[model samples]
Target: MKKLLSFCLGILFTSTLVAGEVGSDCTFKGKKLSGKVQFVTSFPDFKVQIVDSFPDLKVQKVNSFPSDCGKWQEVTSFPDFKVQIVTSFPDIKVKYVDSFPGVP
Candidate 1:
């Protein structure tokens, strides 16, 4: 019985240690634009996607990084929106892009 209990505790601790965390300070502030931007996890890397939004919704990406995330961007704009960060941070890095380029 004791052995089983110890095993369960070990598993619980290990699982908690492997949990993922996302970092982003996005307030998703906008009138016609109301969307939040943040990271999901930094396991392998980040991902990107571009889809149509509501009317006049300006999805402007600022290319941001969490203060605790330890990401840096001397210059913005990456290759595939999934920019790989070069920092030793526990959290992931992120940046902003005008996902919503406003109306024409």
Candidate 2:
């Protein structure tokens, strides 16, 4: 009861935060992120291993959707594209990979 409520609240907060990110060009929108991710070039770039994940970043050579909602799963290797994770106030960062795909 309490735990479930708390979990739901936490998810709600995270979802809102992800959606409230200003100037965010990412098309994926979910309470959680799925697929394996990797930084392209020591930079904040990240790449996931799957495509069914929510909110596909809309980058070529990768299997991502656009502005959706769901959970994020982690993979082992050979991700789809590059991405950055901002665990602070914003939760995540998908900006740097917006216009520039295949960057790592």
The candidate that wins on TM-score is: 2
Question: How close is every model to the real structure, measured as TM-score?
Answer: 0.24, 0.25
In candidate 1, what are the lDDT values of residues 1-104, reduced to their tens digit?
99999999999877644312231332112111222233333432343233232221223444454122222223323322222333332222233333423331
- lDDT for each of the candidates? 0.32, 0.39
Candidate 1 stretches with Cα past 4 Å from truth are: 20-104
- Which stretches in model 2 have alpha-carbon errors above 4 Å? 1-34, 39-41, 46-68, 86-104
Candidate 1's displacement at residue 32, Å, is 22
Give the C-alpha miss distance for residue 79 in model 1, angstroms. 22
Over 1-104, each residue of candidate 2 has an lDDT whose tens digit, in order, gives: 99999999999887865523312333233322334455443453433333323333333323454222222223346743345544443323333233444212
RMSD of each: 12.2, 12.1
